[model samples]
Target: MTNVASPVAVVTTMDGRRPYGTTVSAFASLSLAPPMVLVSLDDRSQQLAIIRRTGRFGLNILSTRQAALAAAFARSGPDKFEGVAWSPSEGLPRLPDSAAWIAAEVDDYISAGDHTILLAQAVTAESAEGSPGPLTYHQRSFGTHTPLAP
Candidate 1:
């Protein structure tokens, strides 16, 4: 629902030659014992096809300051990584400065309506130092979390 705010994540995967990424707000942790996660992508997305083919992906949890980066990835038809600083983690491209990142291997794909849900196992994960907070999507707008004082 639009009323429910969700954390924003960029899903990245190599398409044989170049890396492809997209801003995704439908990511969630599915398990901790096996370190699993899930992300939903549009059925028609090229990036989704790449992930399916490669069987690997990286989920970068954006920091509040990275809202512009989120917008860049959300757009279609352009090099999303152009001028963006990033590096590879376990062969998957990752935003080195993101709040957190997970390198995952797709375990299953479930078709649901117009989207495909990827159930993955987190092969590796790490958190950046001094992250301000996570970027969030609410009512089609980007925002950040605020702490309440005692």
Candidate 2:
């Protein structure tokens, strides 16, 4: 049994078509000097094809309200973005009403074990005003984070 822990944001990458992205958790920031980040995608993942070919991707951060949406794409099934609302802006895939989103161009790709590390530059970001929680994955399921009282 997987142990549940602190939740982490669920992200969807609309990086490319051939290897289109979906729910991924191995997303994180790698540096801040020039603003760089890394997303770890499975080597065998269909997403690798496009990410490798195009050298660019989108990171659509999921809001807490999108737990179901996150789970929908996370689950083992096809047509992940079939009914999802997305558009190609600036020739990049973008999601509407996301908690926040980032567009990054691949800086470097590193092969590590079963996953490939995509080092990218944060191009732009968008978010809904006010504040919203995030959809997090811990152990295995989609869960919300409980902020500790300050």
Candidate 3:
């Protein structure tokens, strides 16, 4: 996995009126026909519990400019959103400037070793104006990608 850079995104879940978010590089598309996606989280993650309870989540695909935001959510603590700019998207908090935002409902979950794999089906999706490269996580660092010449 270190050889290939994975796109980074901030996954948000709400517990009642309070919101929670974390940086996730293990997010990927599961199916394109039904618009399904998957996100892997530590089994002990608080956001996992909240997502299980609410059966809902928001995936904000971070742009290269949001690297600092990615680092903020990567830490384990309560004040992750300290001064992050965000607003609600269909009741789930979302980063307004993300390259893409997806609102989804939990379809299924499976326990795989130390992580819980969440399979979600998209309910609504949106993307920012103008195409931009995504923020990526690889080799324990954050970076951006450039297109390869054909």
What tens-digit string does per-residue lDDT give for candidate 2 at 1-150? 356443343334444352244677777777788787788877877666766777778787777777777767666654677777777754666666667777888989999999888899988766667647666777777777787999
| Model 3 C-alpha lDDT per residue in residues 34-96, reported as the tens digit of each score | 999999999999999899999999999999889989999999997787787789888898996
For model 1, residues 31-142, the per-residue Cα lDDT tens digits are 9989999999999999988898899999999999999999999999649999888887889889867999999999999999999999999999888889998999999999
lDDT to native, each model: 0.93, 0.69, 0.91
TM-score of each: 0.96, 0.83, 0.95
> In model 1, what lDDT does residue 71 have?
97
- Order the candidate numbers by TM-score, best to worst: 1, 3, 2
> Against the true structure, whose lDDT is highest?
1
Whose TM-score is higher: candidate 2's or candidate 3's?
3
Residue pairs whose backbone atoms clash in candidate 2: none
Ranking by lDDT: 1, 3, 2
Looking at model 3, residue 149 earns an lDDT score of 100
Clashes of each: 0, 0, 0
Task: Show model 1 residue runs off by greater than 4 Å.
Answer: none
> Worst lDDT window (10 residues) for model 1?
77-86
Worst 10-residue stretch by lDDT in candidate 2? 10-19
